[model samples]
Target: MGIGDVSKRVLLGRKLRSSQLGETLLPKRIALPVFASDALSSVAYAPDEIFIMLAVAGASAYAWSWKIGLLVALVMLTVVASYRQTVHAYPSGGGDYEVATVNLGRNAGITVGSALLVDYVLTVAVSISSASQYAAGAIPALVGHEATAAVVAVALLAAVNLRGVRESGTFFAVPTYLFMLAILGMCGYGVMRLLAGDLPEAESADLVIEPAAGWEGPLGQVALFFLLARAFSSGCAALTGVEAISNGVPAFRKPKSTNAATTLLLLGLIAISMMMSVIVLAKQMSIRYVDPHELDRLRTAGGDALPEGYEQHPVISQIAAGVFDHFPPGFYFVVTVTGVILVLAANTAFNGFPVLGSILAQDGLAPRSLGSRGDRLAYSNGIVFLAVLSMLLIWIFDAETTKLIQLYIVGVFVSFNLSQLGMIRHWTRHLRTERDPAARRKMVRSRAINTFGLTLTAVVLAVVLLTKFIAGAWITIIAMLVFFLVMRAIGKHYEEVELELAADEQDKVMPTRVHAIVLTSKLHKPTLRALAFAKATRPNVLEAVYVDIDSRATNQMLREWDERRLDVPLKVLHSPYREVVRPIVDYALEIRRANPRGVVAVFIPEYVVGRWWEQLLHNQTALRLKGRLLFAPGVMVTSVPYQLESSQAARDRRRRDDHRVKAGDLRRGRVVRDDDQNQVGR
Candidate 1:
């Protein structure tokens, strides 16, 4: 293997056959982490957001943290149930975009698609940024360079996912499960300690919180309502990845919808449980957290400020520290696993965004390149695209989770509202045609569920807009609008191209005359081959066209043409500006202008090289000439490739590669038995 191939194999592992796609499908246990990691990992930071927002009003408002969690959990449950209907109704993995397009109109679908696209990008950015924050907390050396750490984390995740879905999932499964175990086990043991009246207070319990200036004397009902609304909206970050399962139904094993739904239920239950437990424990232990910049608000019991650079640990970190203080290993275990899982949470977007991009490409709404899978049978282009976008966001926001969080749940809620509305329409339309009484009843129940989901999500959407619009949420909105316009423009462009290319009687008509011109620089093997091929066509007009870039070579070529007694005529196009492509292009156009009714076929002699540097060394002039000639009317550009020795080596290498066994060969029914193999060997 070449160095490049070996490096690729090392980075992405072995390529899987298309038949191995079934092996990539996940059972519920694996799918839970694969699709639900984002939602599950939010338990690490979602409560932090809630506490931070409430901290603005001092510890007095902290009493409402669990209430906000309940509300957010309620919305999550509604979304999960609504999407269960979606999975069963459209198990082809179209998810929200498909539901909106089919039941609502194309514009609605595009809006949902754009929202989901932006949401996926933010998922990676937010999750990785949060992970970096946790890493910095655990390792103080990484404190100031969070953005750089997050960028590196994103690169690592993208590389793992490029290997294929199942491999990536397997790689991440252990950490995700460990995070669940650590957090839940901590919560369970903390509760037991509390019941025994031996629960320890959080490290920050002695620090008194001072409410922000405007919130110090909160007395009006309007003020309290707005404060709670803001806290609730921030808490809803937990719901960011709930819809990933809907978009990834096809990646599940047989009975895909059922498995996806079960995974979705598990995600909601675990995320809700963890979030509530952390909030309650923080309150029970008097954990104090505020915006990182507002550390002045925290005071010692003596009414003195804490020392400079007093970094407040995250809510979960503090809770873990307090709950496992006696068992130092448990605290380290929870902290380590939480940070790892938060980073891997971005894996959900890596898997989801690519599949959605592929579907969009298939629908002509995205770049066609996204539809092509890489050697590992994964959407490698989409994976790289997501990584680049996430890196840009992390750089722009400096990988600060609080800043990135403002741009968070807005896109998700936009998709949620639209998708729930779409699901309602989907069930309504189906109810009209579904004849069985039981199925009708089921459709009615599902429609009702979607309706409730829509209502709840619409309210949350309003709150997200109202609370977060100025806090960077408008960036998410603008991104969605840009994506929607770009997709619409792409669809329109494809439609115009298809219409223009439709076949008709004119397509079948032969040209009045065939005029062939072989583009050549010298009378060497490549040029001679081009001339011979052009003559084989037996055109009414055949000539060799050369631009006089160098007088010495031109003179030598003319002398060889005459001395060799070549049957084809040789024409020299002079260039005063010392340009190659324009002279030859002008000559081709001049010929077409003279014989407007005839076709001008320009055959350019080109060298095919296996090495990358060889490609750069040759074919500069020929490539430019062909590109210019193709746009001219009544002109056809053709390349007669002359393969170099390197090309033969490349061909042999490919032959050897084609014979190697891949992951899904047996499932594809292409496996050979031992008897046939032995006969061939003999």
Candidate 2:
């Protein structure tokens, strides 16, 4: 095999056949980490966002941390329940986009699709950027290189996912579960210490928070409400990945919808527990964390600003330090696992975005390329697209979580609100026809749940728009609108092409006569073979056509053809500017112009080179000629390949690859028998 093939196999493991797709189906254990990592990993930073927002008003606003956490958890649970209903109702894996399109009409579906697409991009950017920050906190070397670290992390995640869903999930499952255990263990230990009245204070417990250029006294009710709304919107970042499960129900194993719903419920319960527990612990331990760039807002207990070069850790890091103070290993374990999960959280987007992209492609709203399966049966194009766009965003924002977070949840909530509204309409239409008592009762329950979810998510959407638009949410809205318009244009293009290509009565009619033209440069084996193949077709008119770029070469070719007593007439088209492709294209069009009801067939000799660079030296004129003739009306262009000696190397490489071990081959009991070798030999 070639060096490139070996490198790819080493990176991605092995090629998986189409039949092995069933083996890639995820079970609950793996699927939980694969699809739920985003929502679960948010606990690492969701509490930090809450604390950072409230820190604007100093510790006085800290009292509302638990309140915001609880409210966010409520919204999360509502979303989970609503998506459970969605998965059960629509298990085709289209998720919210499908629901909206089928129930609310095309525009609503397009809106939801565009919103989710933008949110998926933001998910990767925000998750990897946050992970880089956590890495910087734990390792001093990564402080100023967060953007570089984030881009590298995104590339690695894309490679892992390119291997396929089940494989990548298995690789990430350990870190996700470890993160859950570490936080839950820390929270449990911290609570035990609190009960024993021996819990140590956080590192920043003594530091005082100063309001950011605001009043030092009590605020009016309107100001208080605005502050709460801002904090709540920031805390709702935890809900960013809740809808991924609905989009990925087809990835589950047996009982796809049921497994998906169960996974969603478990995700909600675990995420809510971890989020609220961390907030409670941070408050109890008096963990102090502000926006990293706004460190001037913090003062020492002596009421003076801290000295320069003093770094502030994340809320979880500080809480971990305090909770596991006596055990340094436990502290490092928590920190390490937190960083790993933050990176793995982007896997949720990797899984969902590709699936959604495939569905959009199938619906003609996206490029048809996104619908193709790779060697691993994954939507690799979509994965790579998301990775590149995410790296661009990370670089643009310099991997600052605070900067990217403002653009984080607005798209998600826009999708959330519209999805729930669509679900409400879906059930209402179903209730009009569904008659069984038990089924009707279940549908009614689901409708009521979605209705409630719509109300809650709508309020959150408004809050997010109001509080974050100026903070950068407008970028996300603009991105969504651009995606919507682009997809609409793509759909229109596909429709027009389909209608133009549709066969009718005129398509089946036979042409009046066939005129075959052989393109020749010299009387070599390739040219002779092309002439013989063209004559074999027995066309009404046959001729050897040459572009006379040089008069001496054209005269020599004419002398050889006349001396050989070739039966076919030889025609030379003169190009004053020495253009090869356009002259031949014009000649063929002139032939078709003479007989309007006839077709002209043009056959050109092409070299089949094994190596890429060799191809650059040959077939330059023939390639351009074929491209031009393809656009000519009533002309059929064909390439008669002349395989060079070097092509044997490519054939040998293909033979080797066919015998290589493939993914799931052993599990499927596929042994490479003698017949496989004989087939390659043949």
Candidate 3:
């Protein structure tokens, strides 16, 4: 139809009617990648974070890597189990926010909502930033421009997601599955090599790690405990995306809760296995990894620093290199899929955040626009909002995964702790009236699971605050506070507006009289049409009003009006300041003040043009006058459109679009061929 419409059609495909929303429901196969990619992709960076935190104490502390992995796995499993109960209980898809609100109080619900919103934004930032790091390492061209690459990646991801959840999920399902296969296949082969006693060491195995300042000697139990706690806190990033599935339960097809619960189980198990495998394999292969910024800590066995510009590979990459040493394709495939999957991991957030935003909007805690679906049946506003916020974070942090990682997980854990606590309360409250013995037993079991989850997550949240507050976690806390305050203010505003807009008996009363004024600048077709329309309304009083910015034209129009012997009277208001809009506005306000029980109707003629540039050529005064009159009490502004000849172009374009053939026209028997029409006529 138009350039913009064609471009949008190409980018987002054809728009679907509201009835097609059911067609967009994701099956379990597609839902896994859509909702679980974030949790699954964490294996790509969780192990690296674990090693980086442990590297501060040098490689000697690396022996605890597997222990931290196990601890994280335990927390992840507990969270997954807890959320299964959540999905079953709250299949309407409010997830943590709903649970907290219903069981706890409004404040607690808002806290969970604010926390989840912040976490979803951070999910996209961290996931895409990590992907950028992998890409930079694989392709040296992107080394210095990681932030730029990350921003572009985020933009493209948002575009794909704007097409709708089911479509985006189908698109991302391939890479997500490939990543799972690559990592699992690599782990399986690595385990086989280990069993055969032929597993080779990583490329960095020969390098020795030097402990940072104050950690050169053996540490006391207190120091060791603190070091382990920091490492564990960082490792717990694996649990970040577990709640997304709970938030996205409605996206799944038939038996939504069951499919979602199954997906969550698969996510937890696969993520745990991959993370544990990577950490164990790295340990077995003696992968000497450290913070990328602190590469100086790595030295050769002869006490010599590494060659200048030596780049340290991530833990998974090193393990892939060692495991696939004999097969170059295997290594490349693993690396390629790992990078791709990290980018697609942001898709999970893209889906979850919008749905959560919609829920918040429905609750009056977010802008109403967030609750509306775009033409493609997606929450386009929410998606764009998340993308912009994430790009800002990526730019601010320079797309450094390590730096961004510190601000990660804090919000998710905040939601996790509150959600689990709420779930416990949920089951407790239901058990009071759930007198069926079988259902009561089930409720008790779920409560116990939630209780355990709460204990573990509470401990993790405290440890995260304790270990990461100075390491940039404070930024996340401040962000959550800002979200909380903003949402509260929005809810309050909505409530006040609802009260103000409530209709009263006085609202039904009609105005005592109608005072009509047709705004005229010249005695031409548009002005004549406006005057005729105003007279047709049969108001109590009617006059043609003009703002005399140009006296000569005004006098000439007056002479023509008198020559034509027009029945309607013309009233001219002289403007010394050459202002056209203010005089009309003041006149209308004066009339409104004089007749408080009456309505003043101002009629203005506006030109309708087809070409975009023609719009700026006319209607300037009418636009300004209408804008001013809208705010005056009891004043009504009506636009009488005068379509120019060029306006036919827009009407013709719409007519052509209406006849365009769509995909299902043939099958639906809606297509008509000229030949068929002629035969029917005969």
Candidate 4:
């Protein structure tokens, strides 16, 4: 093997064969973590968002946190229920995009795709940023460097996800369940303390949050309503991962749709319970919270700014600290797990985004690269793309969850509202054709569910837009528009290519004559080798061609051609503009125009090298020539590579990389990733 292959294997682990894909298919235990991590991780920071919004009006607004949580819960329940219908209706894993396209037309499908693309990007950004903040709070050395930490977290998450959805899901399920258990356990204990009339106070309970500029003091009823709306909109981050279940129904074992729907329902219930409990507990304990930048506004009981370097823990962290203060280790455990869950939450996006991208690619709405599966049956390119984009956002925003959260939930709510509206249309259209009485009743019932979901989510989207458009919602809107145009362009290009490649009698008919052109930079072994190969082909016409960008080089080559008396005829194309591709492309087109039935075979002599820099040194001209030639009609470009000696080292490196320890290496016996999987024996 080559050095490149060795490096990849050493860094990324073994390259699983196509037959070993079954080893990557995760069971329910692991799948839950992989798919549910994002929603479960929201408990780490969702409570903090609710409290921060409520803290704008001093302690009085804090009472409404629970109410907002319940509202979010209601919407989440409706959304989960609606998606259950979707999974059953479209078991193909196309999710909302498929639902909309099947019923609402191509435009709606494109809209859903755009919205989902934006939402997935935001999911990675928000989750990683939240995890970074949590880490900063837990580790003092991490302060002021959370942005860097967030990027690193994103890289790690991407690596895990590139291992494949089922495998990532299995690894994630533990953290998802652990996070759920930890928060629920803490909430239950806090309730017991409340009943005993000895519930402890939060660390921030003694601190006061001074509201930001316009959010202060007693306001009119309209203003109050607006404030509440803004708060509700922010709390909707909990719904970011809800659509994933619809996109991942096919990942489940037998009865994929049924299992996915059940998982979705469990996610909703768990999320609601966790979010509401955290909010209520924070309110009861007077947990003080503020936007990251406004941390300067919070003061202690003695009317002093809290210590300089003071790390403001999140509401859940504060609650955990207070609730488990007597057990120091337990407090740290809770905090650690919460942070871990946030990072893991991004796993949901990793699983969902690639699946969606693959479907889009299959339909020619996304780049073909998205449809390319890796050795482990994972959409690796998609994972890498998300990771890089998320890293940029984290770095730009300093990994401050408060700042990043502004850009969080808008796209999700947009998708939800559109998807629910589309689902209503889908059921209505189906009911027209599906005339069985029982089926009609079911469709009507499903439509009602979707209708309610649409109404609820539309209101949330409007609130989100009103509150966050200036803050960051425009970012989401712009991203959606960009994706919409890109996808449309891809679809158009694919259609154009399909039309261009359509076959007829002319396509099958052999060319009337073959015209050969050999690219000659200088008269050497490469040029001589090309001449011999062309002679072997015995084309009707053959000549050596060179772009004369410089007079001295052309004159020197012409004199050499005369002195050497080369077998092939030499022809130089004059170009005063010093262009590389355009002149050659035009010449090839002119040749095709002269004889429409002729095939112009352009042979490019290229050097094959092992090192990255060697590639830069060689094939600079041939690569560009080939790219331009492909766009010209009736032309075929072939690379005739003479492998350089450096390539041998690369080959050796590749062989070493593919060598791996087998399944039975351990004393405890073999540990197969997927139990039902079997090896592809040689």
Q: Please give each candidate's TM-score.
A: 0.95, 0.95, 0.97, 0.87
Candidate 2 Cα outliers beyond 4 Å, as residue runs: 649-682
The global Cα lDDT (0 to 1) of model 3 is 0.91
Which digits, one per residue and each the tens of the lDDT, describe model 1 over residues 560-631? Answer: 999999988999998878998888778888888998889989998999998888989999887777777778
* lDDT digits (tens) for residues 274-306 of candidate 3: 999999999999998888888999999999999
The alpha-carbon deviation from the true structure for residue 485 of candidate 4, after best TM-score superposition, in angstroms, is: 2.0
lDDT tens readout by residue for model 2, 155-189: 99999999999999999999999999999999999
Better structure of 1 and 4 per TM-score? 1
Q: Given candidate 1, what's the lDDT at residue 518? A: 90
Model 2: how far residue 417 lies from native, Å: 1.2
Q: After superposition, how far is residue 445 of candidate 2 from its true place, in Å?
A: 1.7
Best first by lDDT, ranked: 3, 2, 1, 4
Clash numbers, per candidate: 0, 0, 0, 14
Where is model 1 more than 4 Å wrong at Cα?
646-682
Q: What lDDT would candidate 4 get against the real structure?
A: 0.82
Model 2 local distance difference test score: 0.91
What tens-digit string does per-residue lDDT give for candidate 4 at 1-682? 5567667665566677788666676555666677777887777777777777777777668878888888989988999989989999898889989987877788789989889878887888888887777677668899899888888888988887776776677677777788888989999999888889888998888887776778687877998897788888888888888888788776777677778878888888888888888888888888888876778879888878888788777787788888887898878778878878888888888888888999999999988899888866888888887788788878887777667777788777777877888888888888879979998998999999999999998988888999999987887888888999999999999999999989888668889999999888899888888788887888899999988999998999999999998878998998889986777788889899999989998888888898898888888878888888888889988777777788877777666543443554443343333455743222
